[model samples]
Target: MLKTRVIPCLLLRGESLIKTIKFDKYGYIGDPINTVRIFNELEVDELVFLDITATRENRPPNLDILREIADECFMPLAYGGGVKSVEDVRNILSIGLEKVVINSHAITNPNFITEIADTFGSQSIIASIDIKKNFWGKYEVLGVSGTKKTKLNYVEWAQELERLGAGELLITSMDREGTWKGYDVDLVRKITDSVSLPVIANGGAGNLQHIEEVVKQGNASAVALGSMVVYQGQDLGVLVNFPDRQKLSNIFG
Candidate 1:
């Protein structure tokens, strides 16, 4: 079996890094560059930097900030937020980002996925799907930073993204986001089973056991954590934070 990845998901609001609950009530954490320096020392497997407010604010990614974070990062970095065009993808990759994740843009024009993949290869493209369970208990796509709802079914979207040449899928459950209640296993399973491409499960990661559950049950290729790693007063992110290489190997290995 391929080793699973434990990735740190950082939410960037303007120039600073922050954490949020249910995609709202964001609390400023620290500087993005400083966070990158610390994660480098932690020797994490990979990093995901998202400009959480970009799409909601109707703006493009801050390339200048991205460049600074890229320079500080030692591990592979994936960036998303307000990435709307092939040029945006090209510019980000040019500055050394390994992958570009598209949420609102992809939902609006999936062809951009094909265009980006054709130019940069599938491995450079990631489709980030934000989902929320409605009254029907079915997961539907949420857009504009989880404020608006799209009629797209989560499973159908994931399959389409892969068919359009997205190399990976970053799935986040809005209902479970930052709750630390654990991932939405059923939601993860739906996307993972529907796509041949790698799927990274995000939201609701509370502990190592939750990490194991997401991979084993959700069938995710990777598990992404935010508050669990950023909350300074918590045990997971504070006292027992920054998993050692051996511990990571034991979990992913």
Candidate 2:
């Protein structure tokens, strides 16, 4: 079996790095380049940075900032937000990123998924799907940084993204984000089981055991963290942190 990846999912609002809870209540964290350097030293398996406001603000990812991040990062990096056409993916890759994640665009213009995969190889395409459960407990796929709801169900969307040529899926729980209560294990399991592509579970990861549950019970191939690794205390003090390789080995191996 391939080793499971434990990735840090960083959120960018304009040029600043921030963290959110339940997909709202954004809080400033730290500089992106500085944080990337720390993660590089920690030797993280990979890194995912999403510009949470890019699409909503109608601007492309800040290439100048991303270029600076590319220079400091030694591990594989994936970026998303404000990506519209194949050209955006091409440019993001040229900046040394290994993959481009498509969320809102994937839902609005799915053919772009095939075009990007065909040009860049499916391995370079990551389909990002954000989901939230309603009061009635029905999971719904959300777009535009979890601001808009879509009719499609998470499982159906997962299968469609795979069929559309997405090599990987970044599945996030909008409700659980930054809460660190635990990952929505059953939600992860349901989506992972419905598709053949590698699924990266995100949101609500508070402890090492939570990581274990998402992989063992959720059957996720990888896990992504935000608040659990970025905050130091209840006050949400900004810190550059990550699980060391030994801790990761305990769960992944």
Candidate 3:
């Protein structure tokens, strides 16, 4: 059986780390390097860093800060945001990230995905699909940090990503992100069932049970949590925590 990976999705704004809800209301979490050290100690399965403003600002990911995090990270790291060309993908991988994620460009310039995938092999590329429910009660694909909507269907997009040689699909539910309720299992299943590529479900992971739901029911290959892994207590103070060794073994063993 494939072991389900429990990943922490860290949001980046410039060099600082932040979290968001429903793709809005950004909240400062802490320093990226500091958080990475904590997760490294906890032995996290992997880490995903996304530059929330990269696309909007038309800037590439901060390689200087990312290099610092890469030096500290012991687990596999995947990065996303502002990757517009093959050179951008090459530079990110050269820094030691296991994968480079492409979002808005995947929709606006889909051929870019194929270009990168072909050059670096599919496993080095991840397709990030952000979804939000419109007023009409249907899930619509969003881009540019969830500010713009695309007419493409989420599942259809996932299929295209696989066809375009994306080794994995990272799906985030804008409505449930940072809500601490749970993942949108229906939304996860919508893509997992349509494609053979591994699907990493992000958003709405409140607890271990929520993680299990996505894997067992939604058939997701992995689960990525942001707020649940970063905050604690009644005040919801910034805290870097993860399931202990035995607890993690129980979940995936």
- Number of clashes recorded per candidate: 0, 0, 0
Could you tell me every candidate's TM-score relative to the true structure?
0.94, 0.97, 0.96
Which tens-of-lDDT digit does each residue in 123-223 have in candidate 1?
99878999998899877899888988999988888899999999999999999888889999888998888788999999998877788788888899988
Segments of candidate 2 deviating more than 4 angstroms: 234-236
TM-score (C-alpha) between model 3 and the true structure: 0.96
Report residue 107 deviation for candidate 2 (angstroms).
Answer: 0.6
Ranking by TM-score: 2, 3, 1
* Regions of model 3 farther than 4 Å from truth: 233-235
Mind giving the per-residue lDDT tens digits that candidate 2 earns over 51-140? 999999889888999999999999999999999988888889998999998999989998999999899999998899999999999999
RMSD of 1: 2.1
Give the clashing pairs for model 3.
none
lDDT of each: 0.86, 0.90, 0.88
Residue 171 in model 1: shift from native, Å? 0.5
**lDDT, model 3:** 0.88
